[model samples]
Target: MIRPQWEWALDDVEGRRLSTPVTPVFTAQYDAEQWLGEHWRELAAAGAAQASLLHDGKQAAPGVELRFP
Candidate 1:
């Protein structure tokens, strides 16, 4: 059985996909979420406006806004 690849699809302010310097892939959903939680601030600074969880290239959850105060 092929394991599901969990990742985050980042988008910019204009809704265009972002090709960030770090493309992290996880083996589980929880890991993906944890990583995003820790790095969202950096992503926001890098011009990511939002992020969506993806499982095997399909959207797994609604987008999370990457707002920096």
Candidate 2:
């Protein structure tokens, strides 16, 4: 089995931590009340609900209304 290694001090290595442009071709938001039930485990395990929903799931509920921006 092959495995990947990450040496923070290595200069010869090409890390996957590089930044890239994110042209959002598709933008949408999920209904939390709907998704929460299905993704309860995921939501609970998420480090940050806002960050997780926006980045991971592309959902953000700022107020009573959800935004896809």
Candidate 3:
């Protein structure tokens, strides 16, 4: 099952939420990294989708997850 993209915090006064896609294209276990990195600049320039890097306080990868507006 696809994970939820949004989570709510108890302290959110206006019910502000934290959201991010739990499954991105790069989550595919193929050559996703190479394809995503190579085309990301053009994709972003074309306003296709929003791309952001993922990190866990240490390492970063070339994988990208796209979110739509």
> Model 3 — TM-score against the truth?
0.30
The clash count of every prediction, one per candidate, is 0, 0, 0
lDDT of 2 by residue, 2-69 (tens): 32221111011122221221212222243434443454344224321222234343334331211223
Q: Write the per-residue lDDT of candidate 3 for residues 1-69, one digit (tens) a residue.
A: 762222111111232322422224334423444555556545544443443344322124432334334
Which candidate number has the best TM-score?
Answer: 1
Model 2 scores what on Cα lDDT? 0.27
lDDT of each: 0.91, 0.27, 0.36
Question: Per-residue lDDT tens digits of candidate 1, residues 2-63?
Answer: 99899999999999998874559999999999999999999998999999999999999999
* Candidate 2 regions with alpha-carbon error over 4 angstroms: 1-31, 48-69
As for lDDT, the candidate ahead, 1 or 3, is: 1
Score candidate 3 by lDDT. Answer: 0.36
Q: State every prediction's TM-score relative to the real structure.
A: 0.93, 0.22, 0.30
TM-score of 2: 0.22
Q: List the candidates ranked by TM-score, beginning with the highest.
A: 1, 3, 2
How far out, in Å, is residue 32 in model 2?
3.2
